[model samples]
Target: MWGTSRWVRRMAQGLVLIASAGLAGAALAGPTLTIGAIVPQSWPSTAEGEELVLGMQLAIKTWPGQPAPTLVIKDSACDPRKAENAARELVAAKVDLVLGSWCAIGIAPRVVAEAGLPFVSANAERLPKAPDGVLQLGRIELYIVEKLAADLRAATGLRVGGRTSCWMNFEPVLREQYDAVLCPVLGFDKKRWEQAEATFTAAHRRPFTASVARGYAAMEAGLAQLRRIRGGKSASNDPIMTIFGPLPPTDVPAQADAMQLVLSPKLPKLSPRDQAAVTQLLQTKACTCLADNSCSKPGPWADQPFVVRGNVPKCPTLAAASPR
Candidate 1:
């Protein structure tokens, strides 16, 4: 949160488009379908966001036939104002559709609403209702919920650990939805993520008041309290994992840091189900959401599982994976 004047100026100026906004991948043969993607290219704190972009780039390269469509990678920098600017640029470029918004707060729909193009997300919280031509690859939050739910169902035949056994950072904007919708769906009765969303449509209110470190501290503290109250252990009693939304994918540093954070000394192995799903994706270079979308040939491997771990936040050009 800079200043009102700076924020207004940024809203108009757009992100620092340091990387050349070029067409990704080798020149393909077809009519060259064009899709715009806004990624968090410069941030250092968003991991889920980076992973998602990898999913999208993989889709465009391997799915849209051998000759992949031209993907214009723009740096939204995970900022709403920059996102708005990116949307305008995409519309101006006349892309067939917008791949999706980089950050959850960045409503890509609002940006390119007039463009008459589909706003699709390989990953994102499915808008309660699809906004006009918008389509999320999968219900974003559901990924975590589904992953945890399946595990829970196996552990306990019940829906949500038989009661409130967990807590999470709840987005204030989506508080009603969580209290009324998601938590109930997950079977969480009392314990839940205590974090709040970070924005406001009404303008008078601000989102969260702490920085990333502070927020994480708060989230961790609440989670510890919930775990203690719920009488849970790390592996056996506390078998359930927490659900955080996709980090800013467009941001490479964020993704890399996230990878280290989530996959290091603590828990790094994917379950058999997850391993299979990821392997299937890499083998076919295809997407679970659509047959038409796939990754580059001989794409990510079980061990490797990704490409371009930096600011780009994606599996790089097929060329990058296997330099031509």
Candidate 2:
């Protein structure tokens, strides 16, 4: 019996050693990239923050890779101090990249950049001039403002101007005052959007919003950078430059398109004549003369408040309607 006990003890020790080696191997084989996210977890923006995190999670879950990236999330609580603190925590955790949303707007980017981590401002409308380490991912307000002005001028045949406002606080009364309003349209492929919606709804039991879309796009960009690094295809040895450098063109269409002009849904509808005029104007082809260089000479439209790029469809109707 004593000999049998000794043999059993030896067997147990051997098994323990093998298990330890397996665990160490697994740890060594774990994910190479760790992504950190700073988002609001408390206060008024809690819902948006949660949805954004969910979007990031969805992106990771859907990634088709051998070793998936790890995600570490910190809460900013929509406060400047908290955002800074969250960024510091992520830095201490040694994350490879950092993504920030609404609450992380101002200080978080600076903190992450200073820590030598690439910071992606997922929802910033505008970013101050900074080093390449800090980059923005979403549409800037300047584009929205310019697009609105151009659309209004094209449709109304009148000189129009645009100013930025808090879109979230936009009221129907303001729509009544303005001749045109710009609205965001999900620029994603219909099938992809449906899939995302279904997945988001199932997970969160709530409708997906633009905040979530931003989060999803942010993660997608981060993973793309990681892949480039792993493949040794990065343009620069510095990860920050590699991440913030001009992206190579891909066949995939943009997930979000430029803002689209839409009539306000305010009640007490417009008069019949006004409504018809508005409808006709909207149906008219967008003025692409400025974009396409089809115009015989430069016009006032060329003096846009902000720089606009890409060719628009030729605007035959606007040309014909223009006062020659």
Candidate 3:
């Protein structure tokens, strides 16, 4: 009896070791994930691009997971062909995810979508309807434009009244979206709008220009979504709905209609830690205001239909306004 009992125990131990080995093998064979980032590493938006990469790095470092992802950074040179080629290379690399700067390179979204990969643009000025598995991390300016027109009309009582104007010095993507979405919806002509460019080369603590803020916000929001998905807590395929849909608003109304009107909240409330950090960054390092220097200064629009801070128009006054 004693011999039989000893033999049974030995067999059980052998089975346990085999099962453990099988489990370990399965773990070793588990899939690994790679993230591809396409950005302009040189010229013009280079500073903003670098900030974007830093944000991505921060996200990866603070990821709430075991195995970290592999990030493959590709430079698109802010050129359409280069952006397309970068997308192709990422596809060839079999990257599972892609993050890109679509504002600088127009062809990025289309190429990424054609690859049928999950893509998120950290900044996009002219987005078409989101195809499945594609998302934009930054705020689309469509609503902002609409609001500006409405607020201006309400403040000035000036109707579109069959008037046409040219939009000058605007970014290509911004111009396109304005022509396509805002003009049609708001009943205005942006095809020939003329505006001055605002110069604040000596302005200090202006880290959060519209582009840089978008980059930082995109990284924070994207990383939060990724963490939720990685933890198997994501309930929806819509990235926006899954990550930010339920977040509460963290906006503070200012007496200046410009703050209330022009500065629409682009992001939902971030995690408590992120909220404090971002708030400080925007207030200190970044300019939460719009890029138009004249908007904040008293102008003809000030007496027409715009909010004024001191002598500066608070809300953006485009068409006759200047670009930052």
Best-performing candidate as measured by lDDT: 2
- Structural similarity to truth (TM-score) of each candidate: 0.34, 0.56, 0.50
List, residue by residue over 35-142, the lDDT tens digit for candidate 2.
998877665567666777888888888777646788898887767788788889999999999887553366788888888777777653445454456656534442
lDDT for each candidate structure: 0.38, 0.57, 0.46
Ranking of candidates on lDDT, top first: 2, 3, 1
Candidate 1 local lDDT, 1-324, one digit each (tens): 569989988766653332222223332233556667776666533543344344344334324254455667777666778877887899999976665453433566766655666564433334444555454322233234344435433532322221121111121122211211122111111222232222111222533221221222222222332233234442233322222332222212211111100011112255786555433433332222233344434433322212211111232212111101
Evaluation by lDDT, superior candidate among 1 and 2:
2
**Alpha-carbon RMSD of each model:** 24.0, 9.3, 15.5
Assess candidate 3 and give its TM-score to the true structure: 0.50
The 10-residue segment of model 3 with minimum total lDDT is: 192-201
